[model samples]
Target: MHEQNPALGLVHVLRAVTVEFDLLGAEFAARHGLHPTDVRALIHLLDATRAGTRATPGWLGEQLRLHSAGTTALIDRLERLGLVRRSRDTADRRRVLLEVEEKATELGWAFFGPVIGEVLAAAEGFEAAELETVRRFLTSVLESVGRARSA
Candidate 1:
């Protein structure tokens, strides 16, 4: 099989890699008493917004492949744990923004640290060129999969 169509043969390998990541994510969510989608939502929020930057439900929904109303509900749950808060955008009177509520990140790190560290360590030996290749491929997959989900 490889002798005939080797170039695209890696698609199956990529799918397997994606499945492993999903399994790890599911385990993390279950251990933390969260839905996998909720944890995924948290990741997207953390990625796009820093300590002081504002993140909105609309923005998060777009990024996380969730509906605006669903993002609001997930946020409501996170808010109960004092994870986040909704804010009115000062410059745009009618807009709402979500900002990291401080304690949430600290708490997340506590439960998530070991697993994340292990995953990072597993990839630590890759050369810079290899790492760059992996990053480029993975980012391309992320965008394609994300676009597919939203579509």
Candidate 2:
């Protein structure tokens, strides 16, 4: 249903997409016996890795809005599950950095691989210029949401 205000329609569509992803995350969390925050932390860790940034406890705490004790506890749990490991930064022997384990990647791929493939197939139908416009729009939305979160 197209609305007179295209922006409002876009907002509704985005919200629907967000809800579906949230539900998928919830399912994954339940299946793996993990907390919602754990899934969120893993996602952030993955994103940091993709961005070529070292993920430290302090940085993760800031990203997750968690305090030291909470972050430590989360790390400990993930560590026990074999999903993450803490390694001392080679360049800075005293600093610790978080890393996602192979097990975590395997588990994530097993669960999300099909969905990612479906998304890719859908994206393949879009022309390059149309996809670029969609990418720019989503990037702007992400930036705006980040600003709102910190405000």
Per-prediction CA RMSD (Å): 3.1, 1.3
Which candidate achieves the best TM-score against the true structure? 2
Instruction: Report the C-alpha lDDT of model 2 over 39-149, residue by residue, as the tens digit.
Output: 999999999999999999999999999999999999999999999999999999999999999999999999999999999999999999999999999999999999999
**Sliding window of 10 residues with minimal summed lDDT for model 2:** 1-10
Instruction: Give residue 58's lDDT in candidate 1 (0 to 100).
Output: 83
Assess every candidate by TM-score.
Answer: 0.74, 0.97
lDDT, candidates in the order shown = 0.78, 0.97
Error of 2 at 109 (Å): 0.6
lDDT top scorer: 2
> Candidate 2 has which clashing residue pairs, if any?
none
Clashing pairs in 1: 55-98
For model 1 the local lDDT of residue 106 reads 81
- Can you write out model 1's per-residue Cα lDDT over 43-78, one digit (the tens) per residue? 777876755456788878876767878888899987
